[model samples]
Target: MTRPFPDDDSATLAAHLRRQAEEHRAKYVRAQSDRADKFVTSPRRVYELIRAGIRRGTMPHDQTLSEQHLIESLGATRNAVRKALQMLAEDGVLVRARRAGTSVVHDIVAVHDGEVGPRAWAGTPDEGRLTVDTLEISRISAPAVLQRLLGADTDSVLLLEQLGRMGGQPLYLRVGYCMTDATAEEFSQLIESNHTEFPPISVVHERLFGSAYGGSDYVVEAISCQERAAELLDMPVGAPVLLRELITRNSAGAPSELSYTHFRADRVAIVGSTLATTAASP
Candidate 1:
């Protein structure tokens, strides 16, 4: 067989393809980080500027900003602005009424969960302060929903209701349930000591179980606040609120605690992350 000359054009084409792929990957990572930064930082500034514009009559209340308008106003990309607007809406900073587009309403409350310690408050320990007022802990029979979360029979559960605050403002109203025997003694002691502010139940779980507590497998959904919950949160009855229901398990995978939290729409922001999944190879 005759030897064939190597195809120089094919080699060049392969190298070009590799370069293009690298450039595309770099661009994707930069875009993703840029969008995340917008969500983390720029939304607040955007809200401030928009609010100022509205107050100065530069932006009317009835004026609607499409996604493009927001991008232009903030000098951000369309994707970044869209992500910011979604975060704002979830946090109740902006109202997106049906057929009304998006408009600035009130400032959204920033609520940080202390699952990984209290580093969430702008790198200041003081900012992580949880001001406890209006704290009234009362024992009651666990409701059906709470009982299910606790993985216990209704009769075996006791609910502890607490109205919590941060910086003297009511931020979340929570109801926690535990097996009556598991928490009765501590509950009695807490009441006797007149402890107004208790550590998070996760901490309590660790102290009681002698093992560190991991976070719960939980579900978060937005629901209309009940009349009682709404009153405690200072919102109108049936107002929209974020409801988080957590079912905590111990190292043995046994349900240890069930917590139901209703956050004030204006006073709390729930931050979460999404994972990127890769496809399986054939």
Candidate 2:
């Protein structure tokens, strides 16, 4: 709303009046949103909008979510928007608290392209509580890729399967195959003795070999979830998934471990960034 300026020759007075007007307008908006019984939007519709924003990477990833902004943008009642926020929190897409407000869980599994090794992507980058559960650790007959990458003499590789969860919701499943001289039982014993929960793969490598990895290479692709992975991730078979293939090398530049990570495509988004490049001269 616009109002005619007062007959005052002072610009300071005009600024003060504008500040007061803005404060009043904000309060009015909040008051209007508090009337939950009169809005046209339903709670489910508000949730869909929020879900779409998360899936499309349009929501703010680093900032606290604003209840007032959602209510105003969606023309939704306070209760409807509130329920939507709660739903996202339940789904592990957002973290909410009475005093902390709501915020998006931006990257449940995020890492930069240039980071060196499992040291780069092994740790967590999410906002909510995260847990890694060990599913299986066994010896598998070496696949053609592993044999070619590691060496022809590698007859069997150790398989380390894990499930990743955020806020109690399953988000990813990782199947890592390491070309190690140790047997499956020996590796399991080492993992148990090393840390309490499922430790990082690099830690296991260090525990077993007593050396740090040299570096790692990563390749990301889109794929359909197969039966075994779908069952663990709580998604339907044939659903979209993001596959991240990582190959960790020894200090001598020899490939040591090959890992495949599958993330729910709907809950994960990969952003590409270049830090070592510069713009052309003007």
Top candidate, metric TM-score? 2
CA lDDT of each prediction against the hidden true structure: 0.62, 0.72
Q: Give candidates' CA RMSD values in order.
A: 12.2, 12.7
Which residue runs does candidate 1 get wrong by more than 4 Å?
A: 1-73, 76-128, 133-147, 153-155, 180-185, 188-202, 208-210, 274-282
Output the worst ten-in-a-row residue range by lDDT, candidate 2: 114-123
Candidate of highest lDDT: 2
- lDDT by residue for model 1 over 61-149, one digit each (tens)? 44566877766656766555666667667655567877788886543344444331112233443244554333444456667866665
